[model samples]
Target: MISGRICIGLCFIALAMQVSSAMAEVFTYPALRSSQASDPEQSLLTSTQPMAVIYGSADIGAFVPVIEAFQQDNPFIGVEYHQLQTLEMYDITQSQRANGEPAADLIISSSMDLQMKLANDGYATSYQSSETDALPHWARWRNEAFAVTQEPAVIAYNREFFRENELEPPRTREDFIRLLVNHDELLSEKVTTYDIERSGVGFLFLARDERFFPGIWDFVRILGQAKVKLYSNTSPMLEKIASGQVVLGYNLLGSYAETFTQRNPNLGVILPDDFIVVYSRIAIIPRGARNPDLGGRFLDFMLSIKGQSVLQNEGNFNPVRADVPPSTFSSLIFDRYGERVRSFPVGPGLLVYLDQAKRQRFLRRWQDALLNRR
Candidate 1:
């Protein structure tokens, strides 16, 4: 006879397999092709000049203009930008480093934990320049990993739905829970949040939420009781909010949400009035980088006012530089809500939950709360 524990373990394995299959179906990494290749997915800007490869989790379309602007100043060098999922970037960099081959000149990822792990484990090399030196103390770690953006975890909702119903959108976590409870019938299955287990960045946000907010578990429980939808990525949730399939999405990346809301006037973003948890996409240079000089140069460029301007104006990413003007969507938010913004710092503390046993235990507790399971 199969024991209950064994059955549960098998069920989890099956669920993981299904999630992997689903992710594979929905996400495909574009293959690297020659500079002359016609596929826009292949390169941010095709060039035959000396190349500097950048591995990042950012969408190519959003980052292309930054690279194009970078090349305008450094015309002798070309960029080959390869987009990967956050975890994929960490794994590939580690594997390549172990094999004595570096994968890219620079790496950019939303998973601050994984990026910190790489630097902590000696997988990244240190570099310092005027731009790096001028960074806020919290944004750079030992000159090895530097935050390049100031995006926050926020709530996104359907603006038209709220306006038409004469209901005020949630401005804080408590309000969100109250709204869900008070309008249970209207909100049932009409809310969504990250599936933490499947999304590295999502898990990071949840871990931080648990630490920062004492009522986080209770909030998760309310979300579960509301039958909140779960997704591994933010885009689908934003899409659902835009289409009114889901009335609201919780803990979404503010940068992406702001960008999406630009083209989708009906979509709205709200930074919690109680507090805002800001996350940054960290940049690092691999220890085994084939072109370390170019990597350093690019890293410096990314931290420069010009590079940050492109990130803010073109990439729709919030700038990490304090000198950057509050002209972009997120910067304007920062200006208004700076006091509430809790920027996740670059340090060893982020590694706490990454412990295999700790991660599993956290997920188990989260499942119990959010899944209503024993």
Candidate 2:
């Protein structure tokens, strides 16, 4: 009788062990803890050979240090970066997704409208980061994408040129046009700006101007009449300004302006009184990403205070986090230059504006206005 009871007990123990093993096979420890299996940080570290690919711009020199720092904390994951022009990045991402291949893990770019379009098209996955609560509403998408860097579009000028010409920086839109038209001798040979036809961000800036500024076409006409030199990208324009080859650049980004000014005190930035448009570079993880868990963790890291500090120190950009202390930006001299920094609201359906038809129309109109089509 004792032997039979012991045999039955052993059989029951064996069945329990088998069930536990099956459960372990189906659910990870972190997944079991959460209602949904989305928290993948611990799993990602333990998983075999994690990898990610990023599509972004090489012009953002500030991202280099920050990415290097992230890599230090995540040694198990290998990240590959593909540097491409803004439009090229967009096209490649869309094409890859359409081909049914694994989409890129992350997309970061200065073209806010394009990023918004991706989010709207259900191409990106929605993720709420722990640090998102501290950000302004305008910086946070339906948790689909997050604005990681905030840069105000302002006027960049060469101090040496201003002093030589005995000219004060322009304060309003009217003053800006007057300066360009009346002081041609000082600016005619040295002015540099965006080539709207060739640049996604430049065209986006023009679209914003069209929406906000009345008679923006006339403004472009004035710039054309000034005989301004047009460049294909912002970095080249900034380089020319830094070298004093260009006396001034309108609608230059604040982050680039600060970086150049740090290296050359002769470079100056002015925020216009009529209203400054602040642009934020955003990041999103594609819905079909092979490593969504790692991508989500990265998004959280970017929105965190530590991440924003890294951006400010390395990239010279303002933090999207509202709680960032005033002392953090005290080193910045926007107020001293009579510049006002303001954030613009993201309009409804703004992302769909990136359709091919709209883009072509905008480029054509911009060319007509800036290149003297008449």
Candidate 3:
């Protein structure tokens, strides 16, 4: 019910990894009027029709082609999408399930840790098939959560600014730190990154950085002292950088940034060479879903070559299927960093940072370093 866009991306899963031989079942979601839902923010696109409710953090536009194809195949099954912030998606879905109410049929998010938490907590169901089994080790976990896209955390800058100002964008974190320290006066208030407090994926990137880099606190403190800009989401952050409002952006999802950069000759996307934080967008089928049978079919289709091609070409997303050729973005990423693409593996290890006490303490430290520094 929060103020957010809607993108219907859905999947259904079974208790066992084996596929249920029964045909996909259609639920009775007779079309309800939009007025029936009390919350104005929850836009029920076509109610009362059998729908596979999907909650996710991706842009509504990015999901259209995939959803349309699914609907074309399963015309009776409509899609209801609620585009929530990853944190909001987690909290609301967990709360609804805890109350024994119906929630989303599918949950897809870039906040992988949060998705893992839900899977670890038994909020999701599981399904296995040749398609699911085909996934690489790093992409599927516990038969519950599956990564659908291969992307990375990257640094993007205004290409025109770099050319005119003769600035070399950082190729490594060390180079980044040097740039910040050496050009703080000129770059002050001109650098932007995620506001971790408002962004689940942003916090995930920062938390992982802290674990991997011993001196991240010093670099983060410099960001605060330099009065770097903070934003809650990718669209605005990327737009600002492309528009020349910000000279640099950190921890951006490389796939989206690459698309933006392609459209804007003035933008650049760089995966740090010292080490790269490769990530994937994850999808899961929640337990107690209204139309889980259809959800499973949709999920299977999502992982199929046909679906992945739509993702790679139409949606402009990185498809996780190994056979999909690398987009210009991923091709450049590998050309630049080669063997150093360190994947954030899909597993319970992600749960380490989601512990409530640990998460609060981590965020407090991050806040002090990024927002409270003088």
- Candidate structures ordered by TM-score, highest first: 1, 3, 2
User: Global lDDT for candidate 2?
Assistant: 0.67
lDDT of each: 0.80, 0.67, 0.76
Q: Is candidate 1 or candidate 3 better by TM-score?
A: 1
For model 1, how does the per-residue alpha-carbon lDDT over 66-93 read when each residue is reduced to its tens digit? 7766767786676766667777677777
Q: Residues 1-374, candidate 2: write the lDDT tens digits.
A: 01111111111111121122111001001111112236677656555456556667635355655565565666555555555566666665676577776767888877778778778778888777567667778777788877887777778887887888799878666787888878766676677777877666676666777777887888788787777788767777877876788888887777777777777788888766777777778788987887788777666667778777777777777777866543334334334432544454443455655778887887787777777823
lDDT of 1 at 251: 95
- Assess every candidate by TM-score: 0.85, 0.79, 0.83
Tens digit per residue, CA lDDT, model 3, 1-374 = 21132332333422122223212122222222223456655545535556777776777656667776676667666676666667667776666676777867888888888899889889889878877887888889888999887778899998888888788999877788889889888788889888887787788888878877788888788888788899888889888988989989888887678767656878888878777777778888899887777668778878888887777676567778777776776676666676877777899998886788998998888878886555
| Top lDDT prediction, candidate number | 1
2 or 3, which is superior by lDDT?
A: 3
Model 1 global lDDT (CA atoms, 0 to 1): 0.80
Flag regions of model 2 displaced more than 4 Å: 1-49, 58-60, 326-348, 355-361
